[model samples]
Target: MKIFTARLRQTQFEISAANLAQCPPEQGVEIAFAGRSNSGKSSALNTLVDHGGLARTSKTPGRTQLINFFRMDDNCKLVDLPGYGYAKVPEKMKLEWQAHMGEYLEQRQCLAGLILVMDVRHPLKDFDRMMLEWSQHQNMPVHILLSKSDKLKRGPAKNSVLGVRKEIKAYGDQVTAQLFSSHNKEGVEQAREVLANWFGFEKEYETAQ
Candidate 1:
């Protein structure tokens, strides 16, 4: 399958939204990347786009505090959502972030799908389940990335993928998953294929082939 070799390479940071009203115009398709803090969400995004600094990677968890938008083209965009389930922040601030996230997920008209990143060793945390349930309720499709797979043995990494696939089966076929490791470029093509399909770029990729 074709990777994000063309269109996605053009992604550029567009806006950062702290609340729903601050979001850009609700136009075109957008797929959101979300996971718990320190789950390697930003790294996975940079890997997918083949841009080292496209999405900032921080050593501190919960550094991405706003909903950041990246424009791929006129018809497609990618959203880097604030990570959930970090305790370093104030409870009130966490609650406010949760509220804004909920509002965006439930009310965003342009959302086409969700990319749920999870650390390979700790897949499916409580917040991950909550996100899956919410997406299922919204009838939105989800693609899960088991990030940081390079830290695990091959057998364990495969097992983790299987375990997550089984766990997410309750949400139906709308939720699909694969192993990923930004450090070693593992599963980058597979993740890109999913994103391309979600954004209706499969035909373009096929045509290019």
Candidate 2:
């Protein structure tokens, strides 16, 4: 599949936009990754692309302060948005990020979908709910990743996924979710499959061994 091949190929670092005006041209389909600070967004991106350093994982929350872009191909890209709900950051900076993200979500025509990362132990925080509501208003599809699932046992992890799915049902069929763990690489393929669909990637069977 081209998507699988693109994942294996080197993913180029595109640009970091501090605001909508600084962003690259809105051309092809783009899938954005967003979540609260300390939500494992960087780790999930690195794991999703099978590249260790594709997205920087920082110990400190709110370290990612810009909209980082990774080019999967000419027609497809992945965006890592600044994390929200980080109280340690300056209030001014927090408001700036909030404004930037809000404008991008509302006005970016090339945005195809959103992949929201949340800790499985604490899913559906206020910020997450707000994002869902905004996406619903925009008629945008969302695929949530319940990160750090390996911290919980299989039963509890499954329950968390079910709980999130149930809660999002109120938002209609546009929202979906799944359990994920970057450490064990759980749900990597599943996440990729969902992303591939968003980008309209067709699986190539002839190359199969």
Candidate 3:
């Protein structure tokens, strides 16, 4: 497998719908991450690129309100979507976010796949399950990344991964599952391998392609 040399070249952020609306259309392979608030999504992104603080890491939930795009290379983009499950936000705002995210996922033409990050301890919550269903319905490739696996014992991490994979298989075969831990650097290479496969993929995908 090829190791991405330029992991992440730069990162920029926003906090508004209008700003996200202005995003440059994806011209190359794009892998986006979506997950619940405080789920260590940012940490996992940092781990993928071996760069801390490129995307803000925080204890506060729902800090990211816009679709943040990080440039990985000239041909690809690593997307960090806003976290859901925010309670302090207003009800109307929540509805708008739902619509916004739905629209983006439903129609993002260059999106090669989605990396759904979840806390290994928590695995798939209610919202995560729904997103799984959504991806299944769209026939999009979805990788369930069990993030923060360092919190679990080794045996527990393996069990958590197996359980998540089993449950997601019920949803569809489009799902691929793996364990991850930013602290331990577990699954970093695995994630990269999967993304590279997708990035280089063409229609009627086969490993040969």
Judge candidate 1 at residue 164 and give its lDDT. 93
Which lDDT tens digits does candidate 2 get at residues 1-209? 45465663567789999999999998888999999999999889888888888887799999889999999878889999999998889999999999999989999999999999999999999999999999999999999999999999999999999999999999989999999999999998889888878877653333353
lDDT of each: 0.92, 0.90, 0.78
RMSD of each: 1.7, 2.5, 3.3
lDDT of 1: 0.92
Q: Candidate 3: lDDT over CA atoms?
A: 0.78
Ranking by lDDT: 1, 2, 3
What ranges in model 2 sit over 4 Å off? Answer: 1-5, 203-209
lDDT of 3 by residue, 85-143 (tens): 97997888777777788878888888878899998888789989889888888888998
Alpha-carbon TM-score of each model against the true structure: 0.95, 0.94, 0.87
**Pairs that clash in candidate 1:** none
Identify the runs in model 3 with alpha carbons over 4 angstroms from their true place: 1-20, 201-209
List the candidate 1 regions with Cα displacement exceeding 4 Å: 1-4, 204-209
Tens-digit lDDT string for candidate 1 (120-185): 999999999999999999999999999999999999999999999998899999999999999999
